[model samples]
Target: MPHSVTDTTTPASHPTASDTSGRTDALHSVPTGLYIDGVWRESSDASTIAVENPATGRTLLDIASATPTDGAAALDAAVAAADDWARTSPRHRGEILRRAFDLLTERAEHFATLITLEMGKPLAQARGEVAYGAEFFRWYSEESVRIDGRWSTSPDGKSRLMTMRQPVGPTLMITPWNFPLAMGTRKIGPAIAAGCTMVIKPASQTPLTMLALADLMTEVGVPAGVLNVIPTRTSGAVMTPLITDPRLRKLTFTGSTPVGKDLIRQSAEQVLRVSMELGGNAPFLVFEDADIEAAVDGAMLAKMRNMGEACTAANRFLVHQSVADDFAALLAQKMTAERLGAGIDDGVTVGPLIDDKQRRKVAELVTDAVDRGADLTVGGERIDGPGYFYTPTVLTNVQPGSAVLREEIFGPVAPIATFTDDDDAIARANDTEYGLAAYAFTASTARTIKVAESLDFGMIGINQGIISNAAAPFGGMKHSGFGREGGPEGIAEYVETKYIGINPLDATVRNSHTDAR
Candidate 1:
């Protein structure tokens, strides 16, 4: 079922032969095969999936497309290595993770280039991702040795209570294309730190970055079969059996809500522990008491980071009525100035969507918003070009009923609506079923605390825009999915706790009996 990119409809212009050649050379630096049991090899059928450059609509290279059998093999490898990996000393595991962090930092440019080429984010942004992603390894390296439980005396005074943490066993990690490196590292770092072996399925659209990271991990001495990478186009076919298998203990995914729900359903058969970071419809709220320029900067970062192809990207902008007009104008002016082109190009801030399908979806959302009476303030149409590029867009006076306000618009579009007061802003923001992330800009400390406490989101940015960090617990509630993915809590997701109770009298008797023996 995996088809080549050539089979898809081509864009107005293909990458020049020279361009393709240079990209091909870059691709050659990393493994393109399925990594299993410490070695990279072809899939069962040796079929390949074409990875396309969104900026050029040209084939970058073909990676090994895994089949159901290949998936099973990966699961088997993980199962085989689970016990030994779990038994490995926490300090030793931490050391490996630390080394991985070091190697990733040293090769930051290499991985960043692959991210930009495959995922189409600007090069600078890709570099930023590399830095962000590497932090996970660093943070978890320290967390590994700190995964501790507790010992306590029972309230009855007759027994002692003890607890210990252990790896959850073989895990399956599914990462999204929007953050090829960070998402993977966020999941992998914790899994490694907790001594859990895993098989990762990177998004087919941008598997190269993960593949390169896998290579780096191997070089840094991640045990064979401890980590596996399988990039497959037929994800359901490949993952269903693994999910049903008794050997698999945990499943973690970062993607859309629908797919996450389906995976959760599949996991239910085995009662597997699941951690999902699903879709988000984040809101950016601007209050009248806020500093306008600072609020604008926060809006830009909240709305435009990763070209707005992010689950946490602000989907709705609810500005107070007094500052609504000013916020919209300033945001539009800044958006209009962003240069759109290939991510590799110098000074380009925006890049193409992952594929034509994504571009079409963004266009449809914008059209629906406009048709529903939203004012198209700036950049409304698709660009005339070879790539799947849409103009950075800003829509003011967006109707509450518009699709843009309700749905997660994973594009470079910002829809601004007016709110009368704090209560109104909070109501409008929490109207959706999502609770992933939210942002508010205000100068008042009291307002910031009040709004932060009131927002129905897992993460809140009070007066600041960028909220994600390796040291923070990143996740969501409601339909946005559950389970933390960073910080000390992240490692907890990959661990199981065991409680032990010892009766003092029984222990004393056992000791006497042992002495007699």
Candidate 2:
């Protein structure tokens, strides 16, 4: 069910010290209201959605909730700005993005605090997100001027052919909540760099980060209508009309596979170009020759990053039979040692889940795994508190058919399964509908090459836990969705290619006549 919106104007009180860990002032400073056509204002119907602090389950603030009319207006704004923005000099656009990157870095602390408040990532992790997210702007700023095309003679000797890339025109961007700031910058940076105007509908659960980001863009002189942000409780209600509208030339979404499919279906009506970054059930493989300590470190980073709410989080830990016990023991110890609490709290390593619903889902998956013969190594229950807190759990001897092995567990839970050899590991890793990301830890150069090549996932981490980088393309295969984000390929998703051919026969004839004269 969607959260209810209200028209009340009174401000919500700040959470207590225990709730925010002394970051209440930063929370109070976050921007509210919808940003459209360079102006920030209330929704057309004056309704507002309450922004809740996932750590405390307290109302942090209320953001203006956009309606269908507001969505249409945002589209109108994007369409209106499309022509001029596309015509704007690439260098000028690059400069604006560069400034935004600098400004974001300067204001990283502020944005990081807002992200922790709304998205429930630990402050340190949120800071890491800010740094990673800000890099997209810098990277795309460099890419803006590098949008090159091709020119050459045609196969027919008399003709010359040229190809150029143009903005797909006004675009609709829908970002997910898990990594609020990074997700927005990943899409928005490329769109802006490609000279495409955008109407962004950020996830309501973490809209504040993007809302605050809008202010940063505005401060850096992003033109009116080039970017419009609309936050609403009912995403489909607000986005459906825009998705169907002919003016919306492209649609980019980062969310679940089902939602991405629905959006893709709607986009087909207009033959709209689309990009989807959907779900994942990443497998973390540990071979017999792997260093147990290094493998455990990688597992902690892969499985516990963002409290394991990430699509790329390692859902199934596949270890060799020889070292499975050691790997699971070390992983269990690290998982237990993680200090779980409010994101804003100092020294807190793991934060609460996004909300009660997410907590419930994590709990159910753990219960199901335990019921299916998996050994509960450590931390398997929800913490009794006001916040949506769940223990960082580890389950070893996980049954092959356990739901944890098949599903994307979007929480701090790691399930270990044993594999006999390289072939077995590869088979088990690829036995899912999702092929977003996969990891393998092995000291042998030959094994690393074999496993990395054999795995069906789009992105692979040979020995490293972290795979995302601004300079590398990030995307998935199979049901994880199509299209790439980051690197040079990122901006290309927002542009269309056109070919022009010209006959040189007339010019040749004119040259001959001139020579005869």
Candidate 3:
């Protein structure tokens, strides 16, 4: 998956550290060493990764990468902090989490700018992700204090049973590049709230947002060793050692399905707890009774958000045959008209792909579909510019078994397929191994419910484009992966239940006390 880098295009000159675009200040603030045990230090052997700006293909910063020795130190820090963090009162944890939420809000604009600079997301959407990211801290703050257990009588009436929820202990969170700030907060909020200490490893492509988040949490009173952030260029130097350590109680990942499965096998060596939000190939279904106008509006955000880099982004469009022509027309118009430029530029709605390789992958899929008879409604070409830009694409007359429908098309390409009825649409939608998210549009209330229930996905959105929030559990199904990352249930992923049974001595054994009574 690695590719050759060529910085052929010169980066645009911008304002220095005082500029509000925030990249200058943000880049200056990136710690020179790994943040471990609440302090910064260099890794053994001294290796670093060059952080790049996807929009301009410019080297933004050279961050010191974590080595195996550094990762071992981080794991040790978490292990040392686990017991005290677990023993800390839930109310205290909740208060700190809420404080972190407030701090994130206060610095929202800066971090959002950092997100845009690193990952090529438009500024507006980057701010939106900042808001979404902060919500987890707020939601899990309340969730931390609300976690409860129960007591019950045994069947024999001679013993009492009680169940208590305990922290899963030290954990490791491996987040993806697509949502740097949100992914870290999504896992960190619950891990800290559930009294678990953790080490965070954000994707090297986008680690600044995470580094900024770690800074904010430390400033908000997260204790030393309770949280750690380590970024490494090579996985074997860090991942293998950490995943194999028995002391690491849990490891949650948000990445590709193949990598997730590999992590599962690695975690099996220790039988540790794991939560994976992996790859997805979602289907956006539009029925005959649906409002074509409304569905088109939904389609714009559903498929083009983050330039369609999200795992939950609608990958396949299954439109009812009756309204296929109208839906395709409106969708194609909106997609082709979207403005693409640098993420920092004002009014730019669509940005570049993460890299040239990703852009080429998207291009390959589009080429395959076109050769297979899929009509190129609009935008089947790459934008000619300095940035790694690809025009938002829409396609119809899609053939069966095409790569767009079969694989996770993590780009701005929408392949439209027609179905005659509900059964056909449902079958078409459920034909993939990925089942992370599915969407549907219908006027009938009964049909809406029926389609929502019938879709084989972890989450279904009917007449809605945005479904993820801190108040709802977000994860995947089947090859899309398992375990939830948000809502009340999200905190539960970091907890373990223990049942204790108590028995009372027979009354006859205490004759002296009984006589006195």
* Number of the predicted model whose TM-score against the real structure is largest: 2
Task: Write down the lDDT of every candidate, Cα atoms only.
Answer: 0.88, 0.88, 0.88
Residue 167 of model 3 has an lDDT of 95
Off by over 4 Å in 3: 1-23, 506-517
| Candidate 1, position 447, lDDT | 91
TM-score of each: 0.94, 0.95, 0.94
What's the residue-level lDDT of 234 in candidate 1?
A: 95
In candidate 3, where is summed lDDT lowest over 10 consecutive residues? 1-10
TM-score of 1: 0.94
lDDT tens readout by residue for model 3, 10-54: 333332442324345556666657899999887777888888889
Q: Which ten residues in a row have the lowest lDDT in candidate 1?
A: 1-10
Error of 1 at 148 (Å): 0.7
Candidates arranged by TM-score, highest first: 2, 3, 1
Which residue pairs collide in model 3, if any? none
Clashing pairs in 1: none
TM-score of 3: 0.94
Q: Between candidates 1 and 2, which one is better according to TM-score?
A: 2
